[model samples]
Target: MKSTLKKLLPFAVVGVMSGATTVGALQYFNHDSNNTDQSYFTKASNVSFAGMNSAAVGDDFVKAAKTTVPAVVTIKNYQSRTSSRASEQDMLDFFFGDPFGGKGQQRQRQQQTPDNMPSGMGSGVIISPDGYIISNNHVVAGANKLEVVLSNKKSYIATLIGTDPNTDISLLKIEEKGLPYLNFANSDNIEVGQWVLAVGNPLGLNSTVTAGIVSAKGRGIGILGSQGKAANPIESFIQTDAAINPGNSGGALVNTNGDLIGINSAIQSTTGYYQGYGFAVPANLARKIVEDIKNFGIVQRGFLGVTSLDLSDDQLVAAYNKQKNTNIKAGSGIYVTGFGESSGAEDAGLKLGDVITKIDNIAITDFADLSMAVGSKRPGDKVQVTYSRNGKDATTTVTLRDQKGGTATRTKADLSVTEKIGAEFQSIDDKTKAYYGVNSGAVAKNVMEGSEMAKAGIVDGYIITEINGKPVNSQKDVENLLNKFSGTVQIKYLDDYGRGYQRGFKMP
Candidate 1:
């Protein structure tokens, strides 16, 4: 009976093992057949695999960074100031109080006055192998002492060759020759999502590089100079998601090929630190400024003499509806709100409310395109501008003029207001006349406090037709005539209603 029971147990165990094997085989076959329906994924496990395939596809960025970084530089600046006596109220409080330090000690402290010491730090890009560097004007502006440090750890005292605060571009020169430098690329060709690298000295950290992509282009952040001030203030900027901090200003924004694409200038952040959005001066504009600095010692921006606003999608639609009878459509061009007298636009016969559609055959789809086209030229260069008026497309050849509405060369060291009459002015074109319902001459836009005009009771928007009894045809004419006068001068003009008036003042 024991032998029979043992044989039965062995058979029972074998039967159980066979049944488990059969079930496992059936499940494996069923899973494999289900996965076969999706060729891309042989198994459900394949769906969870994570990796990037594009990283293996590009060599452009690595090669570009190698070329661009050497041309980038670190900039340091120093300024000096003197402190003066405080107001009478403050002096009385110091002499009367000071229960914490005693009267004698307070008296001694008052005798030893304290003033602020100037200090600044920024970044720059070497544009020429002969030691020409470009940076933001604010970096070196009002700096009594300028110093430049190279990638090789070599430092040199830099000379302020020129600066244009309107465009916020400054040029510097070092005595050295044959330095490593970068060449500017066509910023108009930069595309969204393209890889870019920002190299600079951030937070005073020497030679730092951060990666990002072009988030946008042709951004106007409402930070431009006024008329008779720097003519080309508030330039269109290249916006990026690069991690730019305070000290990154004036750094290089280079493409993967190591070519200069833009100059990192400002960032949009609430905490005064990196918030993912950084602004850059397009290389196209920077190149123009650099060239002007090298040639004329100043940035001679071509003046259009028009106030413009970017058209939103809805506004474009409305414009298209208004121009339905013509080939022009809304959202397809820039609208001119006002025109300045003797401006390039005025000379070109461009009217207020005209929509600029193209320049030199290049389609102007937005303000960025227009800015890029205009920024590419000097003050005297002529270009064809196309616009739509009353549904008809027309072309006009406009000779670009300086901010003064005349053909004049500029230098980097030239301050628009300080170099001239220390005041701002705008032309009184037909459009301006129509807007104000009357105009006879150019109007004063702004008078700097303590300037020659300010001391003379000259108010902003005051019309001026003559200076020192000489006909002032344009702002340039005013500037030229004022330069001829040293102490006192006479200004003549008509008010908004064409009423003649005259005034006399002393010049600094």
Candidate 2:
């Protein structure tokens, strides 16, 4: 279990589960697709009658299940994990009193070694017959190799195309044609009470389908924030009660019509299993990410350049009210707290106290709504923003910008790995180990030409053995540890004589 799942949901699974963590490195399963044994499924919302017979909301979900199962896939991820990295549960325990919230009694669990390879499973949807698949980023985040198993038991090694951690969406490719796939549905038109099916391989069971309705839309569950990032993570989930489990990440969440509407992303649970709530990345946002990855090799996000928070939370709204000395209603609208230095808010006549109510024709009830609306567009895009100023409605046509406040289309080259990490490290060699008396470590191969590492006076051959307090045995270990870690870090290393040295490094 190298890179043991860094963030255990404490029953708060980010819609990604670990049902396949023990499936072994080279293990593969082929199962019969025709399982017709019916046994009172607890959740299926009724299928709607189109041109056929009349239907009710409690009708059988056979139609939606049958249509979606074929397009959903089980993905096996194989990645080298770090041996000494901490589990997400441990981190949560460090921050919160009870990892699974303050509910009931805390149960002790056995610990396992993390040096083993990561063998996790998740679900994905086939969007194109030519093998363009969409899934959550956490599903294939660190996978050195990815294997996608079709419902027909046919498996293909999937190629990683691009990933957006902020949105938890990734695009994958495989060489296949005329495969059973699900077309993207208009998620915006999906109502809150409409019937939907969650088709995926939960608990490693092939092609399981559960039924439920859209419980809520534009939900921000704080899962992405737990991973740590800058400028707030964009999340607008389609919440449902469709029984999402550990292995259901990246699965197809479809309407009664069997069209794809969302990708199951996280679950709101108590013990890391489904507990009447699950969340999905809306199809519109996922589709946009897929299109951007396919076209630009990077996600080109549009920015409104405004700092705002959702007024849906009672405490949040109360705080804003107290701070601003005004009575703002909760459960509706986004209260603009400030403007981004490079934002169009000021230029577009947006004030600090303005409350955003809508973007274009779409109603924005909270931050999730605003984020999803603006995030789906690209830099240089224009949108009509509607807001309230002292009970008076105001509208402005504003042009969005990138983080750099420019309208340039971003490519993969815009932010290279070197620019991200600041320094390049190499694995410790046998001779170096003998002289250094260290079991494993990474040698600073070369600091970036104008990187923070260079500014910090770090040089080549500086063997980095630890990041913060976690041991780093190799370059991959370093990368895995640094992925979601923001702010400042303590880099501990060994000199040529193996003498220890620690330095402060900031993640830029």
TM-score of each predicted structure versus truth: 0.63, 0.67
lDDT of 1 by residue, 13-44 (tens): 75466347435634544333321101111111
lDDT of 2 by residue, 282-336 (tens): 9988999999999987789899998876787889888878997988778688888
Q: What TM-score does model 1 achieve against the real structure?
A: 0.63
Clashes of 1: 12
Judged by lDDT, which candidate is best? 2
lDDT of 2 at 287: 93
